[model samples]
Target: MEQDLIVVGSGNAALCAAIAASEKGARVLVIEKAPEDMAGGNTKYTAGAMRFAYDGGEDLQDLLLDPKDERLPRTDFGAYTAQKFRDDLLYFNDGRPLSPEQDKLVGRSLETMKWLAGHDVKFEPIYARQSFEKDGRLVFWGGLTLAAEDEGVGLFEAERAALLRAGGRIEYGLAAQSLLVEDGRVRGVTARREDGSTVDLRAQGVILGCGGFESSRELRHDFMGEEWEAARVRGTPHNTGDGLLMALELGAARHGLYSGAHATPMDRHMKEYGNLDIPHGDRKNYRKICYFLGVMVNAEGKRFVDEGKDFRNYTYAQYGKAVLDQPGQFAWQLFDAKTEDLLYAEYRFHDAHYVQADTIEDLCAKLEGVDASAALDTVRAFNAAVDDDTPFDPTIKDGRQARGLTPPRSNWAQRLDTPPFRAYPVTGGITFTYGGLKVDDAGAVLRPDDSPIPGLFACGEIVGGVFFNGYPGGSGLTSGAVFGRQAGYGAAASLSPAT
Candidate 1:
């Protein structure tokens, strides 16, 4: 089959690229490794939280929240300017400045979000996950304001509908094995079907949005260390680095931190692999990340990362590795009734790995593999260190910190004296790898010589360098949309039409 553009991977980025290409009057074909029911790549398992720059509450109102909502009067979603977004991108990389391509991603974020909204993807304020009622006003922190109307699956369905409407075609269960390069230009893709049948798909342009190696045990162990093999996959099991491997075979320059990944603390008892059978609405229940609102102690009953060091969204991705490095490759998040209501929605799952008790000692005793005596002492010492003078607040950096603690609680530090203690067992759940084919600002895949590989483009998790060790919540979706759209337009422009 011949197409004007061949997009590998049926996820958000690929869909966006396909739609953009078709809108330019190009015939686009999307190839997916998963079956029809398992399409959308890692995006299907995400929260669909999208972080972008906006002026303030009034500006965010048009994008997600409604400024005139009767419930919020004093809430301030202060301006998140492009400068702030740029700073955050560099800050997480240890003050190392972003490449020109990364700067382009940040600069075009808001405009690309507007483009998505225009294409029928309804945006809604992420009140449930990103905001809290503080002083009678709903305050949205962390610069993440919006999510798709129904979340990840919702975004996926919407994008799929939009792509089909734009005259784009998709073939499921067909995996792209390699690129067809002629005269140093990608001419098409050679793919194999589920039945082991090979087919040649000729195209003027190719865009790779297939995810990373998080789901491949061998790749995980090779790139992220041996412990990664035991880590639970938080998304699709089909992301085996096919896109990355195909690109590498063609002399594409590999970039970013290959050994790093986006991981988080998930229920220790959840299935090792992501279960598609889990009700779509409840798929995210396996996650146990609200630990920043509490404390995390390892098997030896010792506090590890500073639980209150930052917002859970900002710190959750990296903390999973910390949990994996623990004695039993697991940890427990402890919280009290005082902040119990503040727990993220995922903690309420019926099958969550947790235990509840009226006393701290009883709670610690119930935590299997945990040292009871040390657990009790740790809690007592943590409580004693809480600066009682500082008022408790969850909406912002209230500076209610614990004084003189080894790993000090930097914010929202409250003593666990409120009775009815609870703990949730957690282990590392890997999301996606951070390294893949390097690309330019236009999403054109780059060769080892740093020159563009003609007619080749990339986006999403398979296109790396935006993130490293830390990630701000909601940036993944934003980056996909921004760069995906760019890749589509770039691909279309690279075509010679009827020539």
Candidate 2:
């Protein structure tokens, strides 16, 4: 099929880009392997935090502080990069580019947010006021963390519909197997449809928004190293990086494989928390404290990280355990009646949201196979730390603040002392990947020679440089809107001569 443009993913980024282009009077088509209604990409399962910048938008606090939900703090910066903002601990690679690189990337990030806000996407300013005591264990939480209404899916569908209204077509369950490149320019893409038939899409330009390679174990092993096999797949399950593979086949130069953004997200989410049901996987559940004040321990029941820190920082800390086989592989959140109460009273308003254990022995039985003995011992030690409100004697680097959590006077304060010592298992989920195909500011995929792949473009997760070193809320949608518009409009702009 001949078209003005073709996008190979149905994610928020892809959808946003398609709609942005379609709105501008461009003919576009979106192809996806996932079901039509299923928004299973990173957009489907994200914290959905929309981080507005200091550029010029909302009036918010300079620093993040959540009085009601003290567990997760909100910064005034909203993931903005500034001299006043402290450095992100988890940035392992050269994720944050300076000057020229920063110009294109940060400009794109800010532009994306501006575009989304202009498009009527709600942009809320988190932490516009208030201050609190830094028990030193406070973790940062965004407004976007826990809205599971599938609004993201709705957004994608809305965009897709609008795109179609503006003269675009979306073909779900169609997988692009390869790009048919002629000479140096990308001619088009050959894809597999749902019915096992083949369809060749010929376009004046092609945008690959299919997302990262997180689902492919082989790709993870090849690029991210062997340790990634056990790394949590916390993002959308459908993001298998098919587009990346295709790009490689077309002589796309690879960069930044040695580095990426990894985070340890809580596992057993849908099961343990009773959030959703999965017919394919086993029933897994744990006391859901991922959003609450929590503690993390390893295979030997040792406290690993300051669980209250930024979730991205938590993942970086887990990277330290990479050499330990399951280095960042498994972790557990240890909490009790008091921690649960604080979480509920201020953080989580739901009384029924906590895990209950009447005794240490009972809690042990519940956590039996996972880490019973170690958990029980850790509970006693934790209670001891809480009793005196003193620093834990253990020497965990950068993990002191979490270990220093001594709950301000409560009935259950010293309660490794009683029945039901509760423990909730925490494993990282892959909400997004910090790696992808290299692309220029124009949204064109970069070749081995650092030149644009003609008639080829990328936006969203398909482009790595735009996200900065770490992602802020709304950046994903913002990037797609900003760059998708660029790709679409730019492609449209380029077509004037032909007209």
Candidate 3:
């Protein structure tokens, strides 16, 4: 079929590009590597939390699926300004200044959400995981409050519906192999169908939104390190750097930190890739991110990171790599009964792995692959250091520190003396790779000289230089949507009128 634009992916980014291109009077086609049932890429594996700058609850109220939900009046959806968003991104940039891609992400975030809302993608407050009830009201911290209703699956479904409504077509089970370039321009793409048939589809423009190389063990070991080979994949196994490689083959400049990734603390025994057979909401249950409510210890029975250094949103991504770097490539999060009710629902999931004991000594003894005596000593030290004078509060950084330790707990530190104590075993789960093809602000793939590759645009994880050493929680989806929209517009503009 003749098309004005070809989008090589089916995730939020790809769909957004397709929808946007179609809106601009371009006939768009999307090619997916996964079957229709599992086609949303890593997007379906997320909790669908999207971090964007917003004025206040009013902005969020307008995008809510049910704006009149009873909680709107009582929920404190605090404002997250563009400056705050930029600050958060900079915090993870390893001391580098914000890149142009990051500036676009921050500046376009809220408008992109509004644009997505116009596409019928509904959102709701992420109350269950991001909020804490206090003073008879739900207060959301961490500058992230909204999420796609029903999480990733819901976000994908909504975007798919919007794309279809815009007259965009998606061919599932067709993996894009290489770009069809001619005269220094990308004309289309060659793809392989599930039936082993090959098709050379021609288009005026091609957009690669296909994802990163996190699922490729070889790529992980080559780019990150040998230890990353043992890291579990938290998303789709299909994102083996096909899009990035295809672009690189065309001399598209590689950009961003190839050695960096968005990793998280996940179930140590979770399947190599995410479990797609389960319900959408249950898929994210493999994550164990409530470490601020407790403490984490490596195999040597010693605390590795300052668990209370910051909110989980800021630290969880980097901590996963730290976990992978641990002696056994795993760690356990220990929580007492006092903070039991504060833990995320993932901790109580049926498949969640944990060990419980009535006494601290017994809990330490139950930790497999850890020195029991040392673990016991570590716990005793932690409990003794906790400043019991400071009142415990989850709504904000309460500054209840555990001081005078080798690596002190900076905030939210509490004694783990309450029994029975529970420990959840966790390991590093790679979400997406940080390295990808370079793209200009318009989302056009760039050559090493910083010139746009004619007729080729890129977005999503395929577009690099946005993230580096660590990632602020919930920004991946927003980045995909933001750049996807840009690439769509850019692709449409690049299309020849005759097409």
Residue 202 local lDDT, model 2: 79
RMSD to the true structure for each prediction, in A, is 1.8, 7.2, 0.9
Estimate candidate 1's alpha-carbon lDDT, on a 0 to 1 scale.
0.85
Residues 33-149, candidate 3: write the lDDT tens digits: 899998999999999999999878878866889888888788888899999999999999989999988999999999999999999999988888889999999999999888998
- For model 1, how many clashes? 0
Clashes of each: 0, 27, 0
Where does candidate 3 have its weakest 10-residue lDDT segment?
Answer: 54-63
List ranges where model 3 is wrong by over 4 Å.
none
TM-scores for every predicted model: 0.96, 0.74, 0.99
Stretches of candidate 1 off by over 4 Å are: 61-75
Best by TM-score: 3
Model 2: ten consecutive residues of lowest lDDT: 278-287
Give the CA lDDT, 0 to 100, for residue 183 in model 3. Answer: 89
Candidate with more favorable, higher TM-score: 1 or 3? 3
